[model samples]
Target chain A: AQSVAQPEDQVNVAEGNPLTVKCTYSVSGNPYLFWYVQYPNRGLQFLLKYITGDNLVKGSYGFEAEFNKSQTSFHLKKPSALVSDSALYFCAVRFRPGYSSASKIIFGSGTRLSIRP
Target chain B: EPEVTQTPSHQVTQMGQEVILRCVPISNHLYFYWYRQILGQKVEFLVSFYNNEISEKSEIFDDQFSVERPDGSNFTLKIRSTKLEDSAMYFCASTPPGHSTNNEQFFGPGTRLTVL
Candidate 1:
């Protein structure tokens, strides 16, 4: 079965420091990787996706992700962390079975990223 | 920007009772989907609808769960009989018509269902 994994349950970084939220996937065929962030009491916001282009994908809120095919990892990153960037981050992979035209998103357990002053 | 919208941010229901969660996808979107996250759990896909029919569903989307696009603008998920385990944050999503791998789904804020 296809699945996503976020090794860290929580990641803490000092404000203005760089941050990384790790993610890896187990799936067959080429994978469509995505990053989503959820704020308290808010819906999941799409951050970025790696479809077929460059290994580095940029997204909203100054967030970016690096898609590494050899390792099957798509890690979310930011050059400088902000308090407002603290939220739950999820890594997801879109999978479509060989026989099915419809695809479903398999999400990681999620990692809570906290930025402290 | 156009975004998916869900009704009733929260809903409380009793076990064995029926409940319907409503959503209005972006006007131009043709693919709709429902996903749920149990508190502290990964988000799980329930079902996907397209061309006015269910295109796919997950194992968790048992007979008790059904989805429909009742009108031009409203898509709904009806749980025939709610169970305590059904308590979750249900999210509705949609994307412009395209191959599944190419379209990125836009998600709604989600409805928190509390089954007692």
Candidate 2:
């Protein structure tokens, strides 16, 4: 089956420092990658996505991600971390349904990002 | 900004009871979807609806579950028989048709279903 893996159970970063949450996927054909975040008691929020363009994809709240095809990775990154950035991060991949169906989106286990003040 | 909205932020139901979760996606969106996340697990896709019909569904979306776009504004998920294991947070999401740069699924606050 197609899936993405988030190796880190949790990532700790001091406020003002850069942060990274790793992700890698295994899927056939071109993949559509996305990053989502969930706050305590809140729904998942869209962060960024990588469709078919440049390797660098930037998203909400000063967040960004790098798509490395050869490495089969799409890691979420932020130049500087804020305490507010602490949340549960998820990496997702959408399996494009050929020409007759809706896309099935798959999510990674999740990475807890704790940004310290 | 227009966003998806869901009813009954939290729901408590007895096992074997039927439950319906309601969602109102953005007025202009063309695609609707349902996803659930058990406490510490990944969010799993349940089904996708478009043009008043189901576009796709996953294995978990068995006969027990059904979706209906009752009107122009509401899309609902009905679980015929709720089970204790069905407790989770259910999210409703929607996205536009085609692959536009803005074609990202917008999600609602989600309804937490607790079956006892």
Candidate 3:
């Protein structure tokens, strides 16, 4: 079975400083990783994804993620954090070659990111 | 930008009652999905629909759960019987065709269901 793990339940970073949220996964086949952000009382917003391209993948809201195959990790990163960026972040993984039986996109437990001003 | 839209932002119902959560996905999308999140819990995928039929479903999607695309633009999830544990924020999502690469899913605000 495929699964994802977000080691941190919460992460705190000062505004204007760089921020990193860690994520790792376990899958039998190639992994399709993605990051999403959710604000209070709102739906989840897609951030970025890692398919089979360059290691560094850039996404919405000045966010990016690095796909490290050897480490089995895809960590979200932002060079400069903003107070408005505070939200719950989720890491998801899916298997390529179409895992329709298992419904690709198994999400992690989620990480609460707080940007301190 | 176009987005998925859900109706009945909040619904309160008694146990054993039938409730249907409605959603309007982005035009021209071919795939639809339903997911639920309990308070303080991870999001769980209930089912996925494509071409007017259920392509995949999870264990959580038992006999009590069903999905239908009554119209060209509307997708609905119906729970035959409401259970206490069913109380949670139900999200509806959709994706376009030939999108198996990253499988980016656009979500709606979601409907908060409360079972009494």
**Most accurate candidate by DockQ:** 1
Off by over 4 Å in 2: B100-102
Candidate 1, after superposition: displacement of residue B63 in Å?
0.8
B2-115: candidate 2 lDDT, tens digit per residue: 889999999999999999999999998888899999999889999988788888888999999999999889999999999998999999999877852236788899999999
Off by over 4 Å in 3: A96-103
Whose lDDT is greatest here?
Answer: 1
Worst 10 residues of 2 chain B by lDDT: B95-104
Candidate 2 global CA lDDT score: 0.91
Taking all chains together, the TM-score of candidate 3 against the true structure is 0.96
Ranking by lDDT: 1, 2, 3
What docking grade does candidate 1 earn?
medium
Candidates, ranked, TM-score: 1, 2, 3
Q: Of the candidates numbered 2 and 3, which has the greater lDDT value?
A: 2
Interface RMSD per candidate (angstroms): 1.2, 2.5, 2.4
- lDDT by residue (B29-114, candidate 1, tens digit) is 88889999999988999998878888889999999999999988999999999999999999999888778777788999999999
> For each candidate, what TM-score against the reference?
0.98, 0.96, 0.96
Worst 10 contiguous positions by lDDT, candidate 2 chain A:
A95-104
Clashing pairs in 2: none
